[model samples]
Target chain A: MGPDETAGHYLVANVPRARRGQTVAEVLSQLIAHAHDCMDVVCVLDDDERLVGVLTLAALFALERDRRLGDAVQPGFPKVHATTDQERVASLALHHAISAIPVVDAKGKLLGVVPSAALMHILRREHVEDLHRFAGIARETTLAREAIEAPPLRRLRHRLPWLLLGLAGSMLATLIMSRFEGALAIDPAIAFFVPGLVYLADAIGTQTEAVAVRGLSLSHARMRTIIGGEARTGVLIGLVMGGLTFPAVWLVFGSVHLAVAVAVALVVAGGIATTVGLVLPWLLGRFGSDPAYGSGPMSTIIQDLLTLLTYFVVVSLIVG
Target chain B: MGPDETAGHYLVANVPRARRGQTVAEVLSQLIAHAHDCMDVVCVLDDDERLVGVLTLAALFALERDRRLGDAVQPGFPKVHATTDQERVASLALHHAISAIPVVDAKGKLLGVVPSAALMHILRREHVEDLHRFAGIARETTLAREAIEAPPLRRLRHRLPWLLLGLAGSMLATLIMSRFEGALAIDPAIAFFVPGLVYLADAIGTQTEAVAVRGLSLSHARMRTIIGGEARTGVLIGLVMGGLTFPAVWLVFGSVHLAVAVAVALVVAGGIATTVGLVLPWLLGRFGSDPAYGSGPMSTIIQDLLTLLTYFVVVSLIVG
Candidate 1:
């Protein structure tokens, strides 16, 4: 490694070691030694070598000059898990205003300490990667590799069941359209808003998914609490948005019937989308599945079909 | 508060503290003097009673053993900022793998120490919360009022523009459908596949979005390496599913024209959805938006419009 790289890596490696074997006297000695070395923080580890806690230099200098080292080691400190997803860890730390995180295994054995700097670096790194994934580029297909992973065959398997359900739902949508065939034939304007209504419902679901995912980062509260809050937010968003946009539909299309259909669909979809968005994660988690996977396309597909059905059914009931 | 509530609240506030204006030797003396107290970390603060940095018990123990009091008291260590977001601070500490982090005020004065325990506690809490959010609920609605801030209406503005776009796009979809007037009149069966095709696209997008968002929690290098890998996985999934469903579609639909159309649309939608799912986040992020909203309803709406337009145009040219 070059001089900067070597120096940087050394800084990364040593700072953690300086924090090991924590006790007031030992902590002071390492801080004093590293003060000259210019290290900011040291890692605290549990017996299993997992990160259990952190100790900083400023905290070490607080006791009286005459205070003994043994008197500084206080009991009853909270602990952290080492195997956590680092971004969630970082966000959680922010929520509580903490500086360092303890790294512990599933069984609560401390392995090593993951501090603020490391977590930040990891979060930024992951955020960038997420951006790439969202762009549909193969994440691993580096500029070095330039080879895109062709769409997987198995991906279709995961997608088809939902699509088929949507197919059935679309039949119903068609039924609704037929009910409007007379109006559609007369003005053809009412048809213009169907995609918008579907899209609004789906979007509400999407937003709900994002918020639900964000809420999942909570540790202090139950899942119900988080999901309920998100659902309420979705409904509120839907209500306000639904109220604002359906009129725009009437103005744009000059069809009061279309406007009513769009309004009802958007309003109801907001609540349903939010509810599904929140529900998918919980259901996934309960089944030992990754909650992250629940918020994406599956919810959108299901919500799309449902929203279509709802819009059509409501319109059919009103205009038929 | 009831006993349980009090206990719970106390649990949150149990972060250990270190006194102000003490020397390393003095802190070490008390710690060494009180080894039975289990003082694991210490906080170093300034004369204004603000936090600057942290001192670990381990560092103190090491320092006291070596009698490096003078060296440990230097003003060189990086001061922890009190007003800093906990997420940033936690992440930074993790990157460095430190056990303790110091808090400081705006004037660069010391505040307190955040030990590793608090971080671990928050991670577990968040993991559970994520579980529920994925299921689609509000987290704070059920939690104590103090745990959550009021859901702001400001975020609604971010959502409204997208809905408006969806409205316009949906109208376009309708216009596209209207253009297909003759095709639908010939055989309504083509409409059967519209929802299915759109659903297929939506599902693939979901899988892609989940993978991308989850990647946000991983390391940058890992995320980058995995992006293409994940997309490839999605592609493979698409192919397998496409192969499985194509023959079934051909056998049932019977018309060479419709079958070919179905197969092509499936394959194309699969790829398009996957790629769009991947690409949208990068685009959104480029403009400084949250890529987590990749599975937004607007995407589905727009894709549906595209799907409808593509299908109608393709069918018209081939079978018109």
Candidate 2:
């Protein structure tokens, strides 16, 4: 994890702590004598100051005054290393149904706990960051308020890089369209479906991206299983949409050949789009970048390029 | 709020409640005698069973044994009505830097407090829902895991409604393109810019939608101010992108008229896209639907229709 994005940065060292040998009353007195930033969980340490167990305040409260902390503490509790990513920390807290997560070192020595407030803040920040990245914003603006309220020029700076990259991609798209110039001149109606085909492919791809961005990180399913399911789902969606469009196009344009081309292209583009959407994020995650970065303009352009090629290929075969 | 989405649905009523006359020692004894689901804060009530104040457990623990609850309680603590939206409830907790939020009825009688666990879960769930809605998913699947793991046919069912809507929109795009057949026949090169222009416009509009989705709900600024800033930002983004495209199109196509038409169309499309992106979500929010529903396929299709019209208009005027 980056230095700023680690559990160490979020952990508070001044949380309630106690030795396992201490009695419940003794630990309570010690807690009363000191001011701590987080009191949700008390860390129990051994003679080497290594964490052995954790005791929730409620659990501690329920214990008899004479009960030893060692007997009351719950061993095998969930904890994290200081180098753990902040998102993992928040996830652990959520999974364990605890508000605070304890951070330890390699030797199991107690460091501090990431407080409830910081956990909530981390979750909120990550949510905003993911949204911005999915929309192709350049940097993490940290807050939705700042993202919207920033001066126009500042907003422009954050938004322009992706659009410029998209412009370059658009040039490639133009090159692709130019290759089909022969086909377009043969039948002017061919150009009519370009925007619609590209838009539908992009729309279908985005749904896969929305599911994969966070899902890949959290899901335990193997890549093969997930990819297979997505590919089938994509084809099924394409079939339904294509089936609906075939009659409409044939009736409107009075051409069975053109309708068949468009419908076939839609099915192939759908399969390609869903595959790309799932694979790109999985690849990014493998490469240690954010999976969310795999969506937005980059993947949309890729899907567009493929869809354009698919439509022209299908058109060449069927409309000929 | 809907019945399932209200604060009352998530609140825990069996929590530690104290009368104003109880001393710190008495409250502590009472707490020990009973088990409460949420112990983060103690609610202090009045004679009419109306909530008057709240005291955090840390503060309660810090106080003298003889201190009365009335003297220690903090009035005007942040809270929510039982009918408050769950999103609003979570936002209130984040705003107040509190782990739990008290819920009350119209008479100010305590309903319960939404605990920290519920708050975290709600935030995570809302994040997934917004992502899905922004991608035009038909229904809220609640979990990203569920979204990806559902059976192919089931997944198609969840994802098809919007794609079908997009298909209808695509027909409109085709009709618009058919009208421009005269322009396309005049110069085959005109069709090359369709995909690129439609793409750049969609990319720019998505940025605004990303900013506006959560920003509209959280922002304190008036609609007029937000809209004005977004308009300038949109046009500014357009000018930069259009300026870069002008020379490239001119040099590549060797038609200054075509380049100028494309660039001018780009600028106009940019302005329209940003305005539509921001305004659509604002309108949706005003109409009480999720602001995120204004994005994805719905807004993209709208932006595409306008861009297609803009490009054709500019071509008919300049490239004529």
Tens-digit lDDT track for model 2 on B1-320?
Answer: 35878788888988789999999888877877776777767899898878888876767777888999998877668888878989998888888778788888899899889888788887887888888888888655778899989899989988888888899999998999999998888788999999898888788888888788888889999899999998899889989988998999999999998898888888888888888999998888788887887366788889999999988988898866
Candidate 2, what DockQ? 0.72
Candidate 1: stretches off by over 4 Å:
A1-54, A69-76, A80-194, A219-232, A240-255, A286-288, B1-149, B152-155, B205-242, B250-254, B274-302
Local error of candidate 2 at residue B169 (angstroms): 0.7
Relative to the unseen true structure, what is the C-alpha lDDT of residue B165 in candidate 2, on a scale of 0 to 100? 89
Q: Give the Cα-based TM-score of candidate 2 against the true structure.
A: 0.96
User: For residues B1-320, what per-residue lDDT tens digits would candidate 1 score against the true structure?
Assistant: 12321112212222334445555656654543432211334555555655544554445545544443434544544335544434434454554455545555567544444455443333333333332222223343323222222353533544455565665565676667667766766665556566555555655565455444434433354444445555565455556555655676567666777766766665566556655655665566567654444234545655566556666676777787
iRMSD values, candidates in order: 8.9, 1.2
Error of 2 at B22 (Å): 4.0
Give the worst 10-residue stretch by lDDT in candidate 1 chain B: B4-13
Q: How well does candidate 2 score on lDDT at residue A180?
A: 86
- Candidate whose TM-score is highest: 2
Q: What C-alpha lDDT do the candidate models reach, one value each?
A: 0.51, 0.85
What CAPRI class is candidate 2? medium
